[model samples]
Target: MIRRDLLLTLFGIGAGQAILLAVMPFLARAYGPAAFGSYAVIVAVAGIVATIAALRFDLALSGAEDASIVPLSRAGLLLPLLTVPFAIAVLALALRLPFGAHLPFRSDDLSLIGLIALFQGWVLLGSALSTRRGLFATLAAAKIVQPLVFAFTALLLLHDLSLAMAVGWAAAMAATLPAWRHLPSSMGWAETRATMRRLWRFPAISAPMALLDVLALSLPLLVFAGAYGERTAGNYAQVQRLIGAPLVLVATAGGQTFLKHAGDRLRAGVSVLPLIRRFVMVMLALAAVVTVAVALVGQPALTFVVGPGWRTDTGFLLLALLPVLCRVIASPVSHILVLTQRLATQGLWQISYFLATAGVLAIAPRLFGLEGTLGALACSEFLLYGAYLVLAVRAARAANPLPALSSKTRPLSASS
Candidate 1:
């Protein structure tokens, strides 16, 4: 049942992501490098802000089985709500600054940035709730609708890439409102307040882990932008978006399903070692397949999607990061840590990775330029996969000591 749900969810998400991936290069070409650069900046800022505003509630929601959606919802709303007013004030203040006078775009762009941030926050929150309820189909359907709306609307109403992104995101969020109606109506002020208190108890540990995870994934782009410039960042982002579709669709959908079941099994004192071992093996195999497939067809695929003149270097970057396949494979193990409430340990590992990767990117860029930065990123992922493997082994062993060495048990080192 879990596998079925995962497959369905992946199909839906993968399809949508694939479409977006195909469209991005065309969009980049049509908009030109500067517009693409602007799009990247807006996305980056919005992504970071949205991560902060969500306050790690999305991950927290995966672990929450309590009947207090109201509090969870309230807490989710409050953090982003606070940001809305502050963002306005900051933008207002920025307009008064001398630096603001030198910018190409008006103060209104800041408002648009804030809107994107708020929309992302809501999307994350809504996604958390949807995932918790096993509303995989609904969530998957929403993912599909968002991109189509964004694509068509951008191409039709406003040919501006940045505005298209903003509109598409807003429309997507608006489309997801119906999904929220599926949640129980028992949510209220009292339930929301209590859930907030309970949630706060763990955010100190989980928030950083969540932040690190996002950083680990996102910081590479920033490094690319800083070292090579926005054009380079735009080019790399195009590939990342393409490759990320399958990685997220399969790995993420599987991780969510695994978490729901694994949590229940752990609480019931079921041995999850065999399951973890099987999961690890499956992910490794899938990663291998995806890596090879992408390597074989990636260049032609990119050309076909985005048209001529789009940088082929993006394909090389995608091929370079192919080892991230292993990282995607190991995602379930990380999800298990969250389920087990070992978020502090998880956070520590992720933060260590972020710091290590950031340091590498900073130093490497001065030495080798864009290629050097990509090399740093690849090395960082390899190190992170090593760490994740160790954690997964320890977790599996701890989850079922009796089955520690069963033939069905695959050793983590062996898997590596």
Candidate 2:
């Protein structure tokens, strides 16, 4: 079941990402590093906003009961409306403030950022609802629709890159309308409050983890822009995006599958150790392959695809490889922490990771220059992910009880 579902998702998402990847060279030529850099920051901010927009109640969709689904869906739907507006206002204000002035994009991009974040939340809601219903095909189709729409809209709106992203996200959200239709038109505030109480961990614990996780990912782009410059940020953004595409594709598909399966296994009193082991091994092997391929061809490939003006180099790829591979291995399986009810431990790790990332980015750049900074960041992430994997394994082991021993459970005899 996992293999089948993962393949369907991978195929659909792979195709969509392929389309996005195909047009990227052309887009790079049209927009150049500066614009792409700004777009990366906008997208990063939108991602952080989207993570909180629904307050992460959507995560509760894993194996939710029918009695609980409507209110959860409603919470997922309406929370974004309230949260996104407030977030957008805050972001807009930040853009006007002195420190925000360090960011490359103008305040004009705020509207696009808000739209993208809102729709992205809706898209996440849809994904959650669909996964609950086992609607993998629908999810896969939506995945394809997003990047395909983004590619076309990006070309058409070459004059405004951020707007194109907003349009693309909106289209992706539209594709999930069928899933959203499953949501109740209304839920009483009392019911909503009760439901939130019942699943309080998602909001109180998982939400913070989700936010910190995204911030950790986005810090490099944000820090690079402020400390380095738009051009350097853009160059980093281009390489990061390229490295991230396949990782996202696999993680999304595999994470959804594992989330559902692990939840089921836990509910049935089955240990998820074997499942976790399998997933971690597969992802590790995949990451190793990616690291090797990138080590060999990464620099030349970037130069050929993105053109000479961007200054693609082997040093950046080498410095980035360790972190990227570690992330690929650790991220998809990290959800095991949540499934095993280890959110607090996971939260601590996330907070530590974000702080460490900020500290390293702040200090490393001063001493090591660009490559050294990246190397430092990579090494820190290597340690962070190493710790996270250990936590996840321990949490998974602790979630299941030890088997009982009895005369009936004795080892098989030679003739038995």
Candidate 3:
């Protein structure tokens, strides 16, 4: 079942991501690094806010019941609405203040940026609502719809590049309307507020982890813009997005599969150690093959597809990926922390990682430049992920009271 769900998710998400990837070259041509850099920052901010706005109530969808879903999603849905307006106010005021210039957005961009954040929260709500109803296909379809709309809308809005990115985000989220329909009717303001109080731990604990996790991606873009320049931020954003394409696809599939199985296996006293170890090994080997192939033809390929202007030196690219490489290994293992009910521990690690990465990206660049900073960030991530894997394995071992693996234990293969 784990393998099957993973394969289906991969295929569905892979198809959608492929279309998104296909349109990126055109979007890249339409918006240069500086413009795209600003767009990246906007998108990143919206995404970060959206993740927190949901308060990870979306995460409780799979195990939660109908009575639980409404109030949770209602609270999540209301968050961005209330917060975005305040955020816009703060951003507007900030732009008038001394540190305003340091921000990634313009005064004109603030309202749309806030709206984008609001829409992203909607997307999160839709996903949770859909998942609660077991509408995985709807989730998958929405993934595909988002990028196509983004690419199409981006081309049409070439005159206003930043606006294009913002609208594209909104459009993508809107495209998944059906998924949101699965959300149960609101349980009234009083009941919803009560539920929020009930699930305070999600906000207190998982929300921080979610925020830290997002900051891991957003902080770098913000720092790159601040430390280097808009162009450098754009360049950094480009590399992260391009490289992450394949990595995230696999990670998303692995995550869903891991969550799906980890619960059942834990309840059954089954060992996931062998499975986790095998998953890591398989990923490493796959990463090696992909890395080698990309190294051999990456430059030419980028030039041919994305154009020569977007190309960076092969050696420079290779040296840029301490964080990226760490993510490759760690992303799959992330679900384990959740499976083991280790949100507090995971949040601490996330806090440490965000601080470490931000510190390195900020200070290391002055001493060792881009490569050194990336390397430091990557090394920190490697250590964090290593500890997470260890904890996950320990938890798995603790839960496995069964004598040993038997024929009843289904392998990750299909034949069984």
Steric clash count of candidate 1: 2
Per-residue lDDT of 243 in model 2: 74
Q: Model 1, stretches more than 4 Å misplaced?
A: 21-25, 84-109, 182-187, 313-315, 318-320, 399-416
Q: Which candidate is the best by TM-score?
A: 2
Clashes found in each candidate (C-alpha, N, C closer than 3 A): 2, 0, 2
Clashing pairs in 1: 70-192, 71-192
Per-prediction TM-score to the true structure, in the order listed:
0.85, 0.92, 0.86
Worst 10 residues of 1 by lDDT: 401-410
Candidate no. 1 TM-score:
0.85
Once model 1 is optimally superposed onto the true structure by TM-score, how far is the C-alpha of residue 32 displaced, in angstroms?
Answer: 3.1
Best candidate, lDDT: 2
- The Cα local distance difference test for each model comes to 0.68, 0.80, 0.68
User: Model 3 off-target regions past 4 Å?
Assistant: 65-67, 180-191, 267-271, 399-416
- CA-RMSD of model 3: 6.3
Q: What are the root-mean-square deviations of the candidates from the true structure over C-alphas? A: 6.0, 6.7, 6.3
Candidates ranked, most accurate by lDDT first: 2, 3, 1
| Cα lDDT for residue 149, candidate 3 | 66
Over 252-354, each residue of candidate 3 has an lDDT whose tens digit, in order, gives 6566556556655655667778778867786788667767856887667655556646636676566554456656665775666555555666777778877
Which candidate, 1 or 2, would have the higher TM-score against the true structure? 2
